[model samples]
Target: EPEVTQTPSHQVTQMGQEVILRCVPISNHLYFYWYRQILGQKVEFLVSFYNNEISEKSEIFDDQFSVERPDGSNFTLKIRSTKLEDSAMYFCASRSQTSSYEQYFGPGTRLTVT
Candidate 1:
């Protein structure tokens, strides 16, 4: 079985600093996504990438954010400047190349911004 893997399981940063969070491959998946949950808040979709371009994005993914696949097997999300409001648990997810219409998620990386 295959699953997504994220690095820097926990992060603490000061406001205005940059941050890059990473996740690994989910073989045969055609779509990838990033979502976040602020403490005590509902999970919210941030962005979705497919074919090396953004397929969809929420207002949250503004000028401060970007996504990349520096290598075919890994995907990353970069935040240009952190803000206190940016603190949250970020999750990476993917949908397989099947008809089930299901999306699998990685455990998540928690970001704490001061």
Candidate 2:
């Protein structure tokens, strides 16, 4: 079975540096999304993309964040000028819209900003 996969499962970076987290979801899935969970906080949606354009985005997706599906295979989230508050677990998910909205999630990338 195809499952979502993420790279650099653990990341340690400086507060002002850039971070690129990568993910590859199921091959036939169409919708992709990014969400984050702070240490002990609830998961929050960041953005969603389909057909090479963003379909939805939360206020958290400000000028510092971006999402890309550059090659039709891998999806990525880039954070510029990371912040201590940005330290959290980032998840990449995907699923087809044809049925229920159930989502398949990646193992997640834990980002630690120091």
Candidate 3:
């Protein structure tokens, strides 16, 4: 079975630097999403993309964040300028048309901004 894969399970970065979190979503899915969770908080949706445009984005997805499908299989999230509050577990998810509302999440990329 195919699954979402994330790189650099944990990362520590300076407060003003940049970071790129990578993900390989399930091979046959059409919809993709990014979500983040603070240490003890609920998962908060960041953005959802389909057909190369953003379908929806939460208030948390500010100008500092961007996402791209660099290729057929790779999806990436880039934070242009990191802040201490940016520390969290970033999750990548995908769902196919057959099951658009049910999402399968990656193990997650834990980013530590200090």
Candidate 4:
């Protein structure tokens, strides 16, 4: 079995600074996504990528945010300018092409902006 993995489990940044969260999804997965949980709030979908392009994105994924597959196996989310409100647990998820619809999630990268 394989799973998603993230780096810099915890990240602290200054407001207006840029930060990049990295994720390596299962090798065989086809769909990838980025989500965030703001402490006590529900998980919010940020963006999804497929076939080397963005498949969908939520309003929360604004101009400041971008996602890319920098390599064959690595998926990354970049926050151009960190904001205090961006503090949260950012999760990386991936799913296969099967009908199961089961998404494997990474432990998550906690981003704290001050």
Q: Quick one: best TM-score, which candidate?
A: 4
Clashes of 3: 0
**TM-scores, one per candidate:** 0.96, 0.96, 0.96, 0.97
Q: Judged by lDDT, which candidate is best?
A: 4
Residue 71 C-alpha lDDT in model 3: 93
**Which residue pairs show collisions in model 1?**
none
Q: Report lDDT (Cα) of residue 46, candidate 3.
A: 99
As for model 4, its CA RMSD to the true structure in angstroms is: 0.8
Q: Count the backbone clashes (under 3 Å) in each candidate.
A: 0, 0, 0, 0
lDDT of each: 0.93, 0.95, 0.94, 0.96
Stretches of model 4 off by over 4 angstroms after superposition: none
What range of 10 consecutive residues in model 2 has the weakest lDDT sum?
A: 95-104
Which of candidates 2 and 4 reaches a greater lDDT?
A: 4
Poorest 10 consecutive residues by lDDT, candidate 1: 95-104
- Cα displacement (angstroms), candidate 3, residue 27, comes to 0.2
Clashing pairs in 3: none
**lDDT (tens digit, per residue) of candidate 4 on 76-102:** 999999999999999999999973989
Q: Mind giving the per-residue lDDT tens digits that candidate 3 earns over 55-85? A: 9999999999999998999889999999999
